[model samples]
Target chain A: MWEAADTPNVTKEQLQGAMDQRFSREIRQRLAEARVGIAGLGGLGSHIAVMLARTGVGTLHLVDFDVVDLTNLNRQQYFLPQLGQEKTHALCQLLRQINPYLTLLPQTVRVTEENAGELFREDPILCEAFDQPEQKAMLVSTVLEQCPNTTVISGSGMAGYGSANDIHSRKAARRLYLCGDETTDLAPFRGLMAPRVSVCAGHQANLAVRLILGEETP
Target chain B: MTVTVNGQTQEGCANVLEQLTQMGFDPKRVAVEKNGEIVPRAQYETTPLKEGDKLEVVRFVGGG
Candidate 1:
């Protein structure tokens, strides 16, 4: 239990008031208690993770095995100093800096069929950010089969020449939103650009917030 | 013969390849589902069209 301060102290009302200055107290409360799991810390994942953290999501489960490469600077949040650092670690550090109160669980390991279940057990809302088509397919299939109750929003086909209109929401199944291009051949090897990936991440974050607030997306 | 492309009816000829070409589809990059069954990319050219065939073609692009 927190003690009452002798001097004038910040009350829950004051905290709530401060939150209300920017967002409704109810919305802030919901954001403060939500837990989001982001898989992959690449271009798309970095943006999604940062937005969710800044939005006041209380807990974040960040997973990625790769390090920041020079190429990632074009879009990823990692700075030159953070290059060679594990993406999950770098993103987690950034998230903590953005909101010191945030609880970020960083997993510096690749998500695979063998570990996806265990990693997602702590959080029911998951975001899939893998760039490889085959890996994305594997992650989505495994999550659907193993964590049927959890809501999963995945990114796909965010490459090549396309507009924001290409970013779409498809109901792959009950409680599953497939965000991004649903095309199969848009693998990263086929040339994924920065702006397109960011666009997909924006959609993912928006969809995730809607789901968290108990709203239905078409 | 008749086939459906993206919910639009198209004229299907004896040559499926020529029909696809006429339908403004690039056989190289699109995945074709014929009557709910996925047709392999290799079979796009040789497979013959049939009357009342329903086909779904999905084109892929890259990002993230």
Candidate 2:
């Protein structure tokens, strides 16, 4: 159960007012009407979802089949109590605490090449945050080939304790934008950490915000 | 012929598949864009590379 402070008491209008104070009302309204999709609920996806939700993106389609485990606590945004629960459920609970009015469509299903196209057809902008290389390639190719209407923001090569400055966001194609250093491969000696993963997540989330607000460049 | 791959100009092969193989990329695991248009995986073998054509092949690396 959420503690008293964990529960949000502010009304939707109050939340709108607070966001408007930070940015212009026009920007806030634009964000409130935009829809974004996330393919994984791991380090990059979880952080990206929270960032987008806090930025007031109206609707999110979150898809992931894995359950939260003890190892996820280091980078993923989940509490110990959420362990053994589906990632979609754990993330939705956290996002609701941030923005109760936001529309969250969470699905507990694995994204495969066969279902990826249909799964994300409704999304205008989809974030590819899968862990394995083949899964990342599958989603990017599926969206670019099958779902021509959706633009993909993908992350790669954010691992280990390397300098955050190496990470970058670049437009690989008209509809695909790639983020991260693009060279750091996960190895036996190199493992993922929070700071680097969050840095890459920031790139993906910021690019998503930019795309929503009609600033698609970069 | 010479073609640009990922903003770096380099020697090109007869087709996208050949060039990708020469450049050490698994054609099955990367997305290719030639002259601003996405080349579907099926076309990689038949898509011919032209001189001065711009190709951006994005390969996924392991990590989050």
Candidate 3:
């Protein structure tokens, strides 16, 4: 980033060296060795993926069936030029731009109960970012039942214009970390905005980073 | 019988499953926790609850 800002020449080596300087040697090594699976590419998933990439997570298994519609610009991390592209493809391009040497495993498919286990088998952490209540519940239930070793960081209640303080996280179950207010569903009168959604997404990203680093969240 | 559901105190609930239904929750869509332990879906009906027991009924919400 210094080279980009000052010299107009930003090589991968320079980027890595700068990142290494910012993060401790041990943390950078650990982050570069870990892998995570993001189950959606919407508002929460997009932000979490970018945050993880910036932190230098080694591998990413991204799954998303939807395309970038005009409506997704409010909170999703996508450019207007990518309005019609597949979410996985667009996000992969964005990640590559951020980190040229990231091992990205992206697929364009809707996640279901039958395939969620295999999609996330290699990734120890699973992030739930679906846009439907039933879909989120299905993924969470499947992971808890089938993949006992994988930790699921799920979100809910992040809708409407409300207090950012309402968006917080909790350890819902043994392997489930939920981030949201636990209410505040979106209705016709109450819709999702960027501020509150990003707050929940930040919580999810923070929890994921902490879990990967084996640090307890205070 | 007074039991707390979702942090709200309510009366007349026989078990965790009954309480979930009485609170207008679709038992299949929600997950129940009794005293900080998750009650598996298969055991919600059989998991009995007594007075003063706290429960957390959580379900997914549709928002990005």
Q: What is the interface RMSD of each candidate, in Å?
A: 6.3, 1.2, 2.4
Clashes of 1: 5
Q: For each candidate, what's the DockQ?
A: 0.20, 0.72, 0.42
Model 2, runs deviating above 4 Å: A1-8
Candidate 1 chain A TM is: 0.87
Give the range where candidate 3 chain B is weakest over 10 consecutive residues by summed lDDT: B28-37
Tens digits of lDDT, candidate 1, A1-218? 11224334545466556768998878988988999889888888899999998787888989889999998897787888888888887887776665666788888887877887777876778898877665665565556556656787888777765677877876555546677767634543556667878888998898888888888764
Better of 2 and 3 by lDDT: 2
What lDDT is reached at residue A149 by model 3?
Answer: 76
Per-candidate Cα lDDT values, in order, are 0.73, 0.92, 0.83
Where's the lowest-lDDT run of ten residues in candidate 3 chain A?
A1-10
TM-scores for all predictions: 0.72, 0.95, 0.84
Clashing pairs in 1: A158-B62, A158-B63, A159-B62, A159-B63, A186-B61
Give me the candidate number with maximum TM-score: 2
Candidate 2 structure quality by residue, lDDT tens digits, B1-64: 8999999999989999999999999876688889988887778889998899999999998887
Candidate 2 similarity to native, TM-score: 0.95
Worst 10 residues of 1 chain A by lDDT: A1-10
